[model samples]
Target chain A: MTTEVLTTTGAPLLQVRDLQVTFTTPRGRVRAVDSLAFTVEAGRTLGIVGESGSGKSVTSLAVMGLHRDAEVGGSIALAGQELTALSEKELSRLRGRKMAMIFQDPLSSLHPYYTVGEQIAEHYRVHFRSGRAAARRRAVDMLGEVGIPEPARRAGEYPHQFSGGMRQRAMIAMALACEPELLIADEPTTALDVTVQAQILELIARLQQERGLGVVMITHDLGVVARVAHEVLVMYGGRAAEQAPVDALFADPAHPYTRGLLDSLPRLDDSDDEPLRAIPGSPPSLREPAPGCAFAPRCAQAAAGTAQDRARCADVRPALEPYRSPDRLVACHFAGVPADAAGRTPANVPVPGPATVRPQGTDPDQEVSR
Target chain B: MTTLKPAAGPAPAPADGSAPPLVSVRDLTMTFPGKRSATGRRGAPVRAVDGISFDLAAGETLGLVGESGCGKSTTGRMLVRLLEPTSGSITFDGRDVTHLSQGALRPLRRHLQMVFQDPHSSLNPRQTVARIISDPLLVQGWAAGDARRRAAELMDLVGLIPEHIDRYPHEFSGGQAQRIGIARSLATSPRLVVADEPVSALDVSVQAQIVNLMERLRRELGLAYVFIAHDLSVVKRVSDRVAVMYLGRIVEIGDKKSLYEDPQHPYTRALLSAVPLPDPAAERRRERITLLGDPPSPAAPPPGCSFHPRCPKAQPLCKTERPALTVAAAGPATREVACHFPGD
Candidate 1:
């Protein structure tokens, strides 16, 4: 694909450094995003995964320059332009022309009254400065490109007229209408069904390859990361816990939070009898930043912190450093699978099928075992 | 996924071994009136759920799964008489209960209940846990003091602390709120409870807690559930027999093991393939069947099978004639599928 070649030849499509986002709620200033940084290369998909309120969405919003009434500190460079240095008017011009985003709920993203084609055409004309006829034609072409059937007729229908999956397809078509270089998808398929969700993920991956677009796919689902992402950044308590190639991260996740996240999801192959390793506690709040490792409270394998290792985690934050592999970087004082455990698949393999006999109301099996 | 050995002994046949099913649905259809055109005339009606049939044996849990606007939710609502059906019959213990007037259905209402998806929203924001659980008992005309005691028992049965009774819905977590919702549904000791995506709205950690709690309650209370959800993994875990839904029809129905290990319908295969496997090695190698199109609009469904537009193995027969649910040649006695071209 042209995107893969472009990523290999040129610079990363977008580069972020030391990004920080803070919000002032009624209670106090909340450090929602703390020193977060990552890069999205052309044709490459960078997955940002974390639970709710873990700053995954906030970081994405910061990249899009969409957050309001919040203080942002750090550098966000698109291609060769520094977005943090751009004025609001300059950023506005860059939004649809250079970058676009797709949200979780397409129902709210698209204007209901306007036909899908009209909205896409409006974006086309506004950003591309094409004539009405040309823009309308482009809208239909884009819809067809996104795999929507009967695009000519379907494009004229309002958002409410389309089904959930169709509306999402339309939203994808609109996001690609402008052919933006960077596509920030925030839980784009969370509201979709498994089959439809897979289609959407494939659609995004296919489009990224065909259009040579860099994608920042945000989600709370690791299954998606395993299949679609070229690179992944596991975030916890507003910080990047681990970042590595998809294969590397899955093979040996260096951070405790990443391991915990992977263990929490129920596997399809697990036999109907094995118990799921559900992460016991929820993600920690960032209101009062932890003195030590943010995950220490929930980390089952928290290493013994003497005066040295524990001091940096509490007061001086650790830098994102290369862990065992050169490509994989983790921001933790203690990172890496113990030397002996290296090259071995964790016994925690989720056996396929139904999980083990769970106490009622605890497993999805409750509905079947009546 | 875990393997399920058949429950001990011959799976108990019907309550009292009666020939009549505990719940019977015949030719059930529902249509929602569409909006009026610009001329103030009604537009075409939307056939949300076309004619369908099924039976629920006493103590059995039937699972319904499908995408949005596929009428899965509508079907659940109709079973409990929450929404009026445009056509068909719903018989409870051989008694025709469909079309009963609100005043007349009150007595039957005590036997059937529903648990909604979002515990936070399903519960009253202003009412305390005690009041919420007592509402159903009070509706049944139970004495105030007796209702309070029953509510407390139900709360404890659901694993909530006694101190939680005085607290409002806002005070509890998502899982706790769901426990309260379950407690309220059990207030009247209903025979069947239609829980619609009960755990889909919560976190993964919390989902297990709620599912386990529901299972224990069922064992202890002898309550049955019509579990509705889009998550097949969760459904397969809970249901004894599973019903695979597409558009507005049941594509496949079978015992839990048969449905999970050897799904009969192409749609079921696709749905199963789409489920994410937690194990990286297995996930990388599993065969995936990608479906083609979105679910068709119910208002004007396709000429024949609603799933034809997206079915990978769709044939001419699928487009020309609707399929009927029939016992599969290689399936268990309880297994049935409504597809001309079923299987991967």
Candidate 2:
């Protein structure tokens, strides 16, 4: 994976600060992303995790400068250069070469009529200013680069001819064709099956390492975040709920929403007797200007506290502040999980199986379970 | 009404072993006509479901899970006679309902209800919440006034505002719409409900709400369910017993604890491995088995063992011999596996 990127020390590869994105729908002004801030360094994956309507996808689109009907404000910098101020033509020039994005549905992203190889070749030629024959070679190489078997033959086939996983691989191959320094994958593996999802995640991680590309992964699945993310920023109502290292966040989530999310998900290892402790209410509507904390209504701690605690939480929006460690951020006024007691919980370990579980190849059990 | 007798005839059986299973499926198969090509030649018939069998005791939950086109949805449909099985029998409390005529099946519709994957699409867009919820009751010979009253009661039961019964589906959020779908499924107080990926469309937080609601309903009503989904973790959360499907066959079926903790069939193991666990440490330590390729086309399935093509533990014998479903020789005798070399 030969590539060229600005290899500067001290500064991060991609910097986003106070990024706000709003849509003017018939209903009202919907602030999809509300002053969300995060950054990604080269060779690292920053996962932006949130549920539907949390503005995770909108953040990715704003970075790519792809929002047409929405207003985007604040700063998005790549390689120390601001992107929000760039013109459409200027951004287009930087898109395939400097930064690129992959979406959830590969079929919709890939053109149906054109052969997969020809599309990749066209994209490569447009960005690199190369001849068709030379670009075609690069396209086939990329197909092979993403681990698609029979790259040459498959390149000649259309998107419809390829399977779901192969189509996604082709999309990744095309996205990395110009060797972008920054990659924003918005729910890239959401549409894929779990097995294929693992393969794609491994491919991206490998490519990120070899090319030293900064990656921002957006998804609702915590498992995907756990697998690939070095740092995670959990979003709620288009605002930052919590931010920390992957292991630390999962070990002891500071935000109530994050805690509720972890509680809601049914772990494979947990006994069946325990009913899922789902959060009582649904996510807040972002159509209106939400006063105070958007999550106060659903926050269990706020509800259980005294009248003053509840009033404070409902009357004032909690700013994203450092939670114990400077690196960790939580946006709840009453965020729990004290730093002194942040022990690595055995919640990460699965209950051991009996000796007679799998005798044929007992080793696989160690890989899947604790 | 005359149509209510068939469904009411069966005395509610005890969930214990003292009575037979409420629902017993044996070698159920479904084959659809092949698609005709531009050249006017038809392709091979698709065996969406091929000889799969299971039993669901009263109030029991059977989780049917597989990847896309593995026939989990098709199996769920067949249980409620949505799509008639091409072969084999579906016995409901010792009564064979497989080949029953539509006229004869009318009463049984009250006993078995279906909650679809997409909440919005399954419901009528033109109808109000009241109309949507009362449709089943109306079909079961209830008067309009009585059904409407029942609809309002159901709204409150499913955690929806009773006043909102006059509102349209679009007015409600995704989670609320799903609640309406659950409310409709329970309109006639069904004995067995087949929920085909009911919560897959909603957000993670909202998914918890739906799962909790279903669990509460199941406990209160003593209802049996065939929970169909692709997510293994969610299946493990709700199921008493689970069946792993591959290329239209039940490769493995057993008690949820044993099967998930120690999967017998190679495909089941691989399927379980594919699921991404939420904990980062567990994810880092756990080994994953990536299957070679996508599941083969059901239209032209592979010879002998269907999973042999991508199976990690597949042997040459798997290529020639189609293993029949049999009781496990070691460990749990209740577990049934179809692979020649089952346990690792």
Worst 10 residues of 1 chain A by lDDT: A361-370
Question: DockQ, per-model, please?
Answer: 0.31, 0.33
A114-209: candidate 2 lDDT, tens digit per residue: 999999999999998999999999999999999988899999999999989898899999999998988999899888877788788989999998
Q: Write the per-residue lDDT of candidate 2 for residues B185-262, one digit (tens) a residue.
A: 988878889999999998788788888788877877777889999889899988888999999999998888999988
Candidate 2, which segments miss by more than 4 Å at Cα? A1-5, A337-370, B1-18
Clashing pairs in 2: A359-B344, A360-B344, A361-B344, A367-B286, A367-B287
Report model 2's chain A TM-score. 0.89
Candidate 1, B77-157: lDDT as tens digits: 999999988999999867988898999999878779999999999999999888999998788898988887777777767
Tell me what fraction of the real C-alpha contacts between chains A and B each candidate also makes. 0.33, 0.65
Model 1: residues with Cα > 4 Å off, grouped in runs: A1-11, A150-157, A254-256, A281-322, A330-370, B1-21, B93-95, B279-284
